[model samples]
Target: MIASGCDCEIFEAGPGRVVRRARDGRSLEREAAVMRHARRHGFPAPEVLDADGPDILMERLEGPSLMEEVASTPGQAAEHGRLLASLLRRLSGVPAPGWLQAAPGGPGNRLLHLDLHPANVLMTPDGPRVIDWANAGRGAPGADVACTWLVLATAPAGPSLEGWRDGVLAAFLEGVDAAAARRHLPAVADRRRADEHISAVEKAEISAFVARETALT
Candidate 1:
């Protein structure tokens, strides 16, 4: 077990994991490219120091996890959501290298960060540094947003659920025109319809249910 100074609990076993093996050169290369792209495009992510092999040395961040940091605060949650929305827009605006491909586990035709939870973000002195880029790629920003909302809805709920919703929508759409948001809401919402159609989220009550779970815990 290679325990670095930071929160790195890596293993050097040859089990196909990055920190477990001496290789996965292709995966390392892809990770480097993604990190570089995020950096160049101004997305808050870790800096890559070495990307030659399985053990891609990189800068580790310090500070609170976005989840714990804002777990008790709705205002903070809203602001964070807004920032994420802006970040997604910026990342999508840029052209990713050819190597970045859509690899959704479920049936989908768009790129997405299928698992974007707050735990994956590492807050640093600069700001929130996006920790995990393994699930990022060219996909529907709407679905990404939905997945984001899903996690947000599931995480530690704030004092006021409706207020948090207001803040998230307000911040997430800070620069977006009201008309545009209204117009695109349906399309953005349609992406989540797959889950309902497939019975993953069979009813509107699911959102409230998740909120209750987070709050009660």
Candidate 2:
């Protein structure tokens, strides 16, 4: 078994399946349900093999995370960005389940992966499969995209990573409506600020970005 994060541990149950158990049983069950919903809607995600209380058994996907691949192969930034954009677009078309709450918006009922980022994507032999559905919910597509933008912008970085970040951002924006994403920056920032996991530095940065974006609105 391997520790995945503060709340969960993962174990390779067999050649074809892995099990994830979270500290919060309810959250784990919700995550499993969201993953199943995503897979049913044709999203490239792990199939749920079984679910019992806080433990979820899922198809074991073998591959390095997209974040690792992008860091090692900077030249493939554009391709990876395009793939990510396509996945987001597909996700936008999926209807959120009734249980999920909308992200302070009206008119759209899209399922949102509130924490979509390269680290959550794995490049399997079949394709790029998204994981970590614990934060999945309902929201406007623009808001969801804005959350992704903030994640990319605030990721720990050094001078050398700037070029790779810009390359990926440029490619991703080419496939998305930049104006729409900008419109939701404030709301996204507000939501992120409320997350207990965010550090003071990140909250300040997000606040500044939100202020700038709000001024333009």
- For each candidate, give its TM-score against the true structure: 0.58, 0.91
Could you give candidate 1's per-residue lDDT for residues 30-97 as a string of tens digits?
66667777788666767776665545656656677666655557658667766667665665565555
> How well does candidate 1 match the true structure in TM-score terms?
0.58
How far is 132's C-alpha from truth in model 2 (Å)? Answer: 0.7
Please give me the total number of clashing residue pairs in predicted model 1: 2
What stretches of model 2 exceed 4 Å from their correct place?
A: 25-27, 105-107, 158-162
* Model 2 lDDT tens row, 117-188: 898999899989999887777878987788788877766666545567887877888887767888888777
Each model's lDDT comes to 0.54, 0.82
The CA root-mean-square deviation of candidate 2, after full C-alpha superposition on the true structure, stands at: 1.9
Worst 10 residues of 2 by lDDT: 100-109
Positional deviation of residue 214's Cα in model 2 after best superposition, in angstroms = 3.5
Q: Which stretches of candidate 1 lie over 4 Å from their true place?
A: 1-27, 72-75, 103-114, 155-217
lDDT of model 2 at position 119: 87
Candidate 2 residue pairs in clash (backbone atoms < 3 Å): none
